[model samples]
Target: MKRRLLLVSNSTLHGGGYLQHCQQQIQDFFGKEVKRILFVPYALHDRDAYTKTARDKFKTLGLCLYHMDVEHTVTATVIFISDVLFFSLFPGYEVESVHETPDPVDAVRKAEGIFIGGGNTFRLLKALYDNKLVTEIKKRVLEDGIPYMGSSAGTNVSTISINTTNDMPIVYPPTFAAIGLVPFNINPHYLDPDPNSKHMGETREQRITQYHEELETPSVLGLREGSMLLVEGNKATLLGSTKARLFQRGKQTTEYEPGSDLSFLLTDAQ
Candidate 1:
């Protein structure tokens, strides 16, 4: 089984609809075999609305989209009058149980493809942890060789860690660790410094540089808008209309144009 990944910098371009800019790339990557995609919409607050948006977009691309909703069920068995008294004493306490229809683990196992949308990275990762889908997703992508697509925050979680994402940490996961689908880290929607602007803030490059100040940090790829990486097996190729910047510790940042081979960054030595 060969690993396949399509990591997009942004789901929508400046003037495009949801996933419109990269529809062809997605279709090509998944090919005709993948007719259905299990979508992960945990990044945003409104799961129903987010799922609808992604489902409609994927429909246009000839793929059916589905999502798993974790359901909670409470079952209270009062075998005796004393049990009711016990419950009254412990106000607001009940025998609660959490379950999901078409279990999330099984959904990933049976998915023809997987697509993770963009939003707050922290929220998405936290949800993944809560649902215990991180390991399942990794196994499906790495072992089963299922095609995995990620956009923005989705792309961030595919790497070694979500530490380089531009999103604020609205929630905390078990750890900053990610799925590690790719050996390195990614900074999606990376913006270049505006030489003419008067704003006094650190540039995207400077922030990634600061990440390198720590020991044992992996290299980070700053993916510009409209850019993506197509990884097949051990080879990773840059795609789309823009170039990407590579940030390495103790080294000058290098720019890679579309069609550049970035397989070198997939090594453990990075």
Candidate 2:
């Protein structure tokens, strides 16, 4: 099955309510057939609050949002044996094992749609690893063709890796690698350099250029606020009012307006 994804730059725009900027696109993407959506809100510190916020927004779109909190237990077994050669001598061996409840993985398997909210990229990716949902989510979206939606950090994790994310590394994950729902990397909430600004720090474009300096790194798409990418089968189109910037190694950065075709990003080649 072809992968279906709606990767959004940011959930909320300035002066806009939560997900108000792209609400229509979200509803149209999921459509009426998908009434229930499995939401992953691990990016924020308080999962409950984040889930609640997302749930309320999705509910307005006529969809029910449910989140999963995986619960598991670890058990250790100790075996004691007596040595025949030496009387009163004892040796002990300990083994550790983990057992999981079927709820978490089962939820992904049965989910008709998945929505990952925005926050810190590191935290989100780490939580995915901790809950062992990376492979399960990928299989569900890529193989089962379930509709997938991501915003900000959620969008970051949808790419090949989170190297292009602007969020600080408040936490470390198992690796920078992500879901690879898309072949390229993404820098959400991308900002343009202010010619009149006094700040001397590297601009977003400069940072993306530095990323391109790496050997064989995939292309990076800088998604500005209020911008999103709609991927359907083999076609990917830029959506919303803003324009997106594309950065490739040894090439000039290119800009694309809304309605532009971005299907090239789906391929392995840069």
Candidate 3:
């Protein structure tokens, strides 16, 4: 099956609610068929608390969030190996830790939709590798045609590698390799160079330049604030008012406008 993904640059815009910017587009992506959501809050520090807050956001869009098996009845049991999450029995529609589930991967596979929250990219990748859930999530989204959405650091993981991310490496993961759900990489929360800046720090563009020098094969897209990439089947379009920057190896970096044809941006990396 073709991949169905939504990569958001950022979840909240300043004073806006969590994911309030893309709520309409997000709801439209899953539509009415999606009843359950596999919320992966590994990126954030307090995943348990985040899960409760995340469930509330889903409720705002008139949707319930929970993960269940194929039988339609909630019966799977959870046992968390760490205190990161508390396990809960599948008594009814409720939010719990991903690792707490009996079969973490299987639960993800069975869910109608998957939601990955934004936080630290390194910590998130480490958690995924630790729990051996990287492959399971890939199988569910890429093969099963499940709807997936991620913002900021969450969006960075959707690509082949997290090399292009703007976050610091607070924790070292097994590898810089990510989900590889998308063919290329993304630098979310991309800040354009300011003409009046006199500070000595390198701009976002300059930093990405350093990244390109290291791995020139993988293309990187700089997703600015409030911008997102909505992928349907083979097509990936830029959704929002602002434009996005695209950096290709040995090619001049170009800016992609909103509503423009972005079907070719999803091509495989060289």
Off by over 4 Å in 1: 62-102
TM-score of each: 0.85, 0.84, 0.85
18-37 per-residue lDDT for model 3 (tens digits) = 88778767867766577677
Which pairs clash in model 2? none
Instruction: Tell me which of candidates 1 and 2 scores higher on lDDT.
Output: 1
Cα lDDT of model 1 by residue, 108-202, tens digit: 87877888889999999998888888899999999999999999999999888999999998897899999999889999999999999999889
lDDT of 3: 0.78
Q: What lDDT does each candidate get?
A: 0.82, 0.82, 0.78
How good is model 2 by TM-score? Answer: 0.84
Candidate 3, run of 10 with poorest lDDT: 78-87
| lDDT score of residue 127 within candidate 2 | 87
